[model samples]
Structure formats: C-alpha cells, structure tokens
Target: MKKLLLFVIVFSVLSAATVTFWAHQPIIGMEEKPIEFSIKAGSGVRSSVEQIASAGVPVNPTLLGFLARLSGKSGRLKAGNYELKPGTTPLALIDQLARGEFAQEALVIIEGWTFRQMRQAVASHPALKHDTAALSDQELLAKINPQYGKPEGLFFPDTYLFAKGASDLQVYKQAHSLLQKRLNEAWGRRDPSLPYKSSYEALIMASIVEKETGQKSERNMIAAVFINRLKRGMLLQTDPTVIYGMGDAFKGNIRKRDLETDTPYNTYTRAGLPPTPIALPGAESLEAALNPAKTDALYFVSRGNGTSVFSSNLNDHNRAVNKYQR
Candidate 1:
C-alpha cells in the first residue's frame, strides 16, 4: 500500500514537471526572430493548437490543449495578429492570446493635409483592410457617415491605433466622429463677437488658419487677420485659398495671373468664406479660429522663413512682401 502511494506521488510530480517544461520552452526555429501568428475569428482552441504545432513548434497539441483547459483559457483566445518574438514561451503566448494582446498598428493624419492625402495614406497602410480604395470620395463619405455633405476637412488630424485587419472605414468613422465632437466643443466655447455664422464656417476658417502657418504661436494672429478682414468686408486675398482653387492647374509658383483668376475658393475674388474647408486643421488651429488674438493687423506675408510678418495696411504688407518675397 505504501509503495503504491509513493509511485502515484512520483508520477504526479513527473507530470507536473513535464507540463512546466513544455510551457517554458520556446518554439523551435523562432529563437532568433519574431514570427507573425494569426488566429482566425471563431477558431477553436484545438485548431489554434494544431496551427502552432504546424508552424514547426515542438508542442504537443493534446498536452497544450489539456493545459489550456486546466488554466481556464481554452475559450478565451482572441483572434488577431500577434508577434511571437524570441524568448516568448508557449505559456506566455497563450496568456497573450487569452488577454487579446494584439499587435497594434498606427495611422497618422497630418494637420493641413487635404482629404485626398488622407485617403492616400489610409490606402497605403498595409495592415489596414482596404475597402475604400475603389470607392469614390462621395461613396466613401456615405459609408463613413450618410449625413456628411462633404469629406473634406471632416476627419480630425491625429494618430489612430488599430489592431491588424481593422477596416479603413472604421478608422475614417473614428476620425469623423472625433472631428464632429471637437468642432461642437470649439463652437460652444467660441468668441461671441466672431463673424462665423455656424460651426461649419469656423471649421472653414480653421482650415485656412492651418494652411497659413506652421508656427504654433502665429495661429491666433493669423486667425485674427482673417476675422478682422471678414468683419471689415475686405476680401480675404489669402494665397492659400487661391492655390486651393487652382487645384491641378497650380504650378509650384503663384503668378500675378494666378492671383487674378477667379474660382469658388479664390478669397481674393469671392467676398466671404470658401464653399468648403481647404485642408484638415488641427485642434490648435480650430481653437485659434474660434478665439482669435485681439489685433488690428489685417494682412500678413511669409518672411521666407517659417514665420510671417503681420501688417495693418496694404502699404506695410507690400513692403514686407517686397522685403521677404523678393
């Protein structure tokens, strides 16, 4: 009777040790580099175990399956791409899978970028599921939000994180929603004396401000210039709007003829704000547009450097232009 009890104890200890060894040992051939492993949605633990075994890992599927069940992780494995790096034990991998620790991918939308550029960036990301590539701008917008009248400047400029195989439409929806939320918040806190009739108009002004300067400190000043011009019934005469109006016809340089040419976005020709936003504006630009600096300056010219010189009149603006531009 004592011999039988000793034998059982020894066997149990050996079994526990074996399971520990299997759990701690890293997979074969993946000791030096990371391997991308995927578990499909709705896949059972048995299939996942089989996949690991097939990948040349020296794991006993039956044993691994039993261990997974014992650990209460059999039904908790998530479906997504995972990087099984060197030194990742079988047990660690299982834990990662159970916790839905997927490899995150990032998509960044830069400020001042056009919607077309945003679309191109989305299409170029290899990790994203590309459903919008074949869709037209209108079709894409409809998919993202049916109520959206236009796609331009609707998406917020920020870095969005997603798990692998995430749809482009999902990213677009996130950005669009964020933009709406931010726009509403900015609109609610906007200056009462601002000339913008609606949040959309403020968004348009924000986009203009975003394109006007890269200097963070200058955004409020630039917004003030545009706001002052709008209140005084002065033509915006902004070159960015004219350049946007030129579209494909715009070469690298803006000639005198180009400035004189008329289009819907040509603030020099049109009296008020453009029909739509010219580019995607960041949060700072949006805030600047809503709360402009208190300045009488109406005109500005780029000083050839990143900064610009603000002027109260055309004479000062032309002088700054001649000094910097020439």
Candidate 2:
C-alpha cells in the first residue's frame, strides 16, 4: 500500500510538470513580436493555460491561474482592443486583461463641422455606438448644455483620444471642456478694437469665417469683410448660412432659389448675427474673427477657383463676380 501511494504521488507530480511545460512552450515558427493584436467580433474568446497549450501557443495557464489567485483577481476580464506580446507570460496577459488594458482610438473634429455633422462622424465610428440620428438638435443641445451653454460653436475642434467602447456623451463632454478652456484663454487676449459686444458674438463671426474659407491664410480677410458689413449695417449675405438652414436635404450645390428661400439661418434675409452660430469654430477662426485685418472691404464673392474677390464697394464686387463667376 505504501509503494502504491508513492507511485500515485510520482504520477501526479509528473502530470503537473508536463502540463506546466506544455503550457509554456513557444509556438513553433512564430516570430518574436513586440505586441500582439486580435480582432474578434461578437464576444472575445475565453483563453486558459491548458487551452492555449493544447492549441499550441507558448502560454502557461496554470501559472496565470496561480498568480490570479494569489493576487485575489479571478474572473475579471475586460473586452476591447488589446496589445500583447509573445514574451509576455500567460500570467502577464491575464493580469493585463484583468486590469483592463484595452487599446485606444482617436477621432479628429474639423474646424467647421455642424452639430449634425459631428454627430454623424462620431456615429460612424465602429467602436462608438449611439443613435444620434434619432436625437433632435434640441435634445443634443440639452444633453451638451450642462458643459456648453449654447452647444453651437461651443465645442473645440481637435483630435481626441478615447478608449474602446467610449460613449458619445463622453466625447462631447471632453470636447466641450477643452473648448471652454481654450476659448476663454483666447477671448481674454482678443484685439481690443474688435466691434463685437461679447465673446459669444466673436465666436459667431468665427463660425461664419470657418464655413467661408478653408484656406488658413484667407481667414483674416474673410473675417474683415464680415466686420466691414457689420460696421456698415450691411447684410452679411453669406450663402453658407442658407445651406445650414436647409439641413441634410441641402443637395450638394447652392442654387439661386436656395439663397432667396427664407430661413432663420439665412444671413442675407436676417440682420446681424443669426440666432445661433452655424457651426463649431476652431481657435484660428476665433482669433481671426477677433483680430481681423484693418481693411475697408465690404463685400466678397467666391471667384470659383478656391479664392474670393474682396471689394470695398458693391460695384467692384459685382465686376469681380461677373469676371470670375460668369
């Protein structure tokens, strides 16, 4: 009976050793990698030391289980993109997942995106899930209002980093907070001679500038034309605002009828700044609006070659418009 018991003990020890060795063998022909990434849909796969060993990967499930038990961490796996390495032990991978080391992704918001456009861009991201289409502008404004007073032109445009499964609200809050900080700083340093009554008005002007020109160097000139219009109480007559009012139904081009169509956002029909900004403005646009060049320009018409002709009077503007537009 004693001999049989000794043999049983040896057999059990040998079995455990074999399992340990099998679990830790490097995968044959698998080159060393700095990080390993896996893309799995639905739900991630459940991995164990024995399972990995049986599948022929160099991983030690027993060691992972032992360490997890020792560290008082069991059944704590998080789902998301992950970066791991072959050099990483099974215990390390387990610990990494348990500690929630999920990969991150980034999204960049451009200078002149409207709230609707921003929502669409965010909704299209694979990692983020939200029904932005169902939410009305009012609902979106309300949701973002706690952080941004007017939602329009309130969020700063910039590249932001986010973990996988990040919420749309989270992204908005972050953008809003960053915008508040940057706008406040810029507003404090604005040119003293700017005609705006408040920083909000400056932001509204910036949004117009942002929509009017993509050329960074031309922002100040565009802003100057708007300021000139404001000083003379001339209508802004900007076409971008008309397009904005039409919303998504705005078929890709601007037409003469569309410009004449009455809408609250149509700067041609409405006097002074619109009730709200047309889109989110970036720092450069904001600065340009606040510090427009000293010029007598009162009118501008796009020359159709990615440039606009500026004029101090309507006749000059019309001549340039006829020359370039026609």
Candidate 3:
C-alpha cells in the first residue's frame, strides 16, 4: 500500500511539473553537440527512452514513458535512428518519436562512373552502416541476387535518400532495382530495328554511348554512329572500351598497342559487345541506345568544344578529326 501510494505521489508530481516546467526542460548530455541514437524496431516507449538514456542522453525515462502513455501516444512510437540535440524539450522529443522522422542521408552515384569507382565511393561513405564493405564484388552481387554475374553498369546513377544508419546495401539495392526498371521499360519501348540482341546488350550500348558522347545533347548521334558501325559489321572501335580493357595500365592516354591488344572490352579487337558493362549509364544514354538517330553516319569526331561532328564516310571523318584533333 505504501509503495502504491509512493508511485501515485511521484506520478502526480511529474504530471504537475510537466504542465509548467518538466516538459520544457532541456535534456542533459547534448549541450556540446548533437548525439545520434537509435530505437530498434518494435521497441516500446520505455525501451526507446532507456536506449536514448543509455547513449548518454539523460532524460527521465519513466516520466517520459508515463507522459507518452497519458497522452495516448505510446502505441504511436516509431523506430529508426534519431538525433538528440541541445535545447530539445521533452515534448518535442516525444513528438519527434511519434512522427517517425528518421534522420536521413543522401548518397549520389554519378553517371558514367566505373563499377570500381562506385564501390570506392560506397565503401568510403561515412553515413552508411558498411554491411557490404567486407564482401567481395561477386559476393556483393550475390547478396543482392544470385543471378547477377557482374556488378558493372548494373546500378542506376541518382541521388538516393535513406535513413541514417541504413545498410549500404540499401543504396545498392535501390539503385539496382531502379536500373532494372529503367532498362526493362526502355527495352519494351525500344525501336524494333535496333541491333541489340537483348536488353543487356542495349545496356552495354548505353554504357558506350554514355562514355563516348562528349556533349550531353549528342547522345543520340553518338549512339547512331556506333549502331551504324555494328550493323555494317565494322568494329565498334571505341576508345573507352580499350581503356576499360587496359584497366590500371591506362595512364590517361591510349596508345596504338593498347587499342591493338586483345581483351574482352577492347572493341577495336573484338566485333561484339564487351563481356560486361564498362561503366554506369544514365537514363538518357539508355534511351538513346534503344532509339538511335536515323542516320547514315558511321563515324564521329569530337569538335574540341564539348561537341562532335558526324560523317557518313571515312574521308570527312578524317578531315574533321584533323581539323579538331590534329
């Protein structure tokens, strides 16, 4: 009976204090800087408050939990990582928890970046949980799905927003899913006469177009030049493919022998698409690959002003190349 009476008295004091003082009081241990904490999925009000307290955020867990229950917000508690900042009142904290406002982070995967570059960026991201950091490239692909044989050009380039502390794989999965959606949709709406044997081949063409198009507006023309080359049984002969084949050996320049060297990605030495994508391709590149411009042009020369000049024959291409490149 005394213990019950003591509990009622303490609860009464906290309730009265909340109206005038307690709810407005600043939480302890966050004056210097904000602290990040997490409430695990399925955690109740007491567990969440205690977890925050355990992370050195000194708040009256019992009183907060009691107030939450009294205010009919106990069942509304949402889980995820959160930030506890200085001057955060008890009422505001509860509201934050109730609204499921998780701390968010943005990661950008750039278009035309290699798979290795993408991996490096993801590995070095500070906000991610790094669950896939130790996984091998193939193993990482397997973690996403066993059907994935390679990682290159498989992920879409975009800004992804995820809850802070989310697994890095979440970003990967989101990108992969989005890329597949875009690729499949583009394939479905593709020009029927395109020379690609499959959607994957279109993806390879997209990667090539992404790399070779120096000007953003010339993607369709670049795709057409390559498509014309492919249809005529001529070499794709793209420099980026040769550089991709050279791997670390490329020193910011492509030599004659480098183009002559036989590798799966050396389009100068091989007649068909490379074994895998060489870089991530953006949606515009994919669209261009599926629907190249209708043109007789089989060659392109960069105009040195971030644009290209196309030619239907070798003589004109050589003249343009001499004017711009030589």
Q: lDDT score, residue 161, model 3?
A: 91
Worst 10 residues of 3 by lDDT: 23-32
Ranking by lDDT: 1, 3, 2
Clashes of each: 0, 3, 0
Candidate 3 error regions (>4 Å):
1-35, 40-42, 53-63, 84-92
> lDDT of each model, Cα atoms only?
0.89, 0.75, 0.89
Per-residue lDDT over 49-96 for candidate 3, one digit per residue giving the tens place of the 0 to 100 score: 899888777777887887678768899989999887788877778888
Q: State, as a TM-score between 0 and 1, how close model 2 is to the true structure.
A: 0.72
Candidate structures ordered by TM-score, highest first: 1, 3, 2
TM-score, one value per model: 0.90, 0.72, 0.84
What would the TM-score be for candidate 3 when compared with the true structure? Answer: 0.84
lDDT of 1 by residue, 23-117 (tens): 88876455376767677778899998877677655668888877788788999988777777778777887898899888788999999999989
The better candidate by lDDT, 2 or 3, is 3
Higher-lDDT candidate of 1 and 2:
1
Judged by whole-model lDDT over C-alpha atoms, candidate 1 comes out at: 0.89
Over 193-284, each residue of candidate 2 has an lDDT whose tens digit, in order, gives 77789877888898999999957888999999989888888888998888888888699998888888888888878888877788999988
**Which scores higher on TM-score, 1 or 3?**
1
